[model samples]
Target: MGGYLPETIVTNDDFTKMVDTSDAWIIERTGIRQRHKVAPGQRTSDLAVEAARVALAAAGRTPEDVDMVIVATTTPDMPFPSTASIVQQKLGTRPCAAFDVQAVCSGFVYALTVADGFVARGIARCVLVIGAEAMSQLLDYTDRGTCILFGDGAGAVVLEPVEGEGTSADRGILGFDLQCDGSKMDLLYVDGGVFEDSNRIGKIRMQGNQVFKHAVHKISEAAENAVIKSNLSMADVDWFIPHQANQRILNGVADKLGLDRDKVISTVAMHANTSAASIPLAWYIGVQDGRVKPGDLVLIEALGGGLTWGAAAIRL
Candidate 1:
């Protein structure tokens, strides 16, 4: 369900030395125990490869059988070669179309939508979609407000075509809704980029309160949109695999939607906001732990930088 975190754990104390923050402060605001950071020299592609391999094995498929690779990462190894292409080569996949999707935290769902379209159109048999991030690379470790909110990790899923009556009961993707508002881009974004900074990525800047306010509303709306698109009522959802941002945000969204708290799968306490990697990682963990099962109706929702948000309804 999820890729392994590096053995080393970085505590808030470790960050206290690097940033102006304390463990008590971080714990009080965000329920993060610790987070995993890739060693220097590790790249997003590396994480994607491992996650993709695990997902492929989980789905009982070989690399050669995969017909597509979609990587969702704002942090890529390089700008020249797409991370998905790098993953494709690493997995030894042949004759497959590979690319990247960038929707910040919602990138996984966006990438999944692309893969779903390919499968539905009979263009691909099996697609490997990965959400990998090295947010540590983009973090301003000295900034207390944002530095403690991010971590590095990756998660993946294997999508395969299935024949069924065209209905919500089909054992695959049923519905999805994606949205973006550039006017709110300043709510959470990096300050510098290509044209201005010699193509070097910049440090992340976030208005925590502003982002928090919109996230709760938009995520709930996306969740409801997905459920309604599937022609299902909220009561029919078996689980909600929400983006693991903060416990408060998750709880707020669940409460707003009147969703059962027990049905929400969360990994924020352990993952510490892995951006695009959150939902897939949570889904993987839930399924691997027997919390999610075949025939379960799973709803996923996410919001992040770029003010992008989306949701997907899938019948497991």
Candidate 2:
């Protein structure tokens, strides 16, 4: 796994100058001390490319070896060509099957699930799965509720097929449980889109209370169901790496699962919510800090707009 954050950092106090919010208020409510922001010329694909390079290097592979590229991002640089395509060209990757997945914060897992299918079916030998977002690009700086809750970053992983006994003990993605409730769209959504005649992009709009309620419930249920599908239980998981949406939500999910807090990998306090990038970013941190190790059983999950939520069980 690999992760990348832009050089610019926005602290809670910085939001105080932009909106009627304070460091204490932001930290107390969202547990976000600061977040990374893209520079003026930076875009989602830029972050994705850097992250992909790091992941490819870590896997001891190169762009030429990649057979497929999947990028999960809501804030793509443009609407025409996919971000994965942009990353491919920028990285000088050979022509390959490339595209984008937009499940928002649950994107990484969604992308991972797709990559798994391709490799499992012997369609792709080396797949680069990335979750990247320039969330700041879509935020309304004046809207304290949304602006203070996001940042820009990317995380990536290389997925390749491995011989496994087809059991829960497999040292790779074992199972996944994905679900979405379009009916709950109002709970979290962007207010504008490409359909707007003004050609203006919409800012994020969220019903925080409603989202918090659903996130805690759905995330926990999805995680549990995923582990069960892997023929394993919560106790078998060595780490719980979830979307870094909110520290409260992370704790809430851990509590619901009766899982130890120490077992959870969280980066929200530092990165805020990088949307799709959160899971892999946190996973990268955990591994870097030596808190997470190879061969460990990991359960990753996330909830995002579309009321989309899912979980993946893996032995890494």
lDDT of each residue in 8-39, candidate 2, tens digit only: 99999988889999999998899999999999
Error of 1 at 91 (Å): 1.1
**lDDT of model number 2:** 0.94
- What CA root-mean-square deviation does each model show from the true structure? 1.2, 0.8
Candidate 1 clash pair list: 1-284
**Cα miss at 277, model 2 (Å)?**
0.5
Q: What tens digits encode model 1's per-residue C-alpha lDDT throughout 1-316?
A: 4474555578888988887788888988988878888888888998999988898888899899998999999898888589999989888998779999999999999999999999999998999999999888899877889889888899999999888999989999899999999999999988877756876669999999999999999999998999999999889999999999998899899999999999999888878988888889899999889999999999999998889999999999
Top TM-score prediction, candidate number: 2
TM-score of each: 0.97, 0.99
Clashes of each: 1, 1
- Measured with C-alpha atoms, the lDDT of residue 132 in candidate 1 is 94
* Cα displacement (Å) at residue 248, model 1: 0.7
Q: Candidate 2: misplaced stretches above 4 Å?
A: none
lDDT of each: 0.89, 0.94
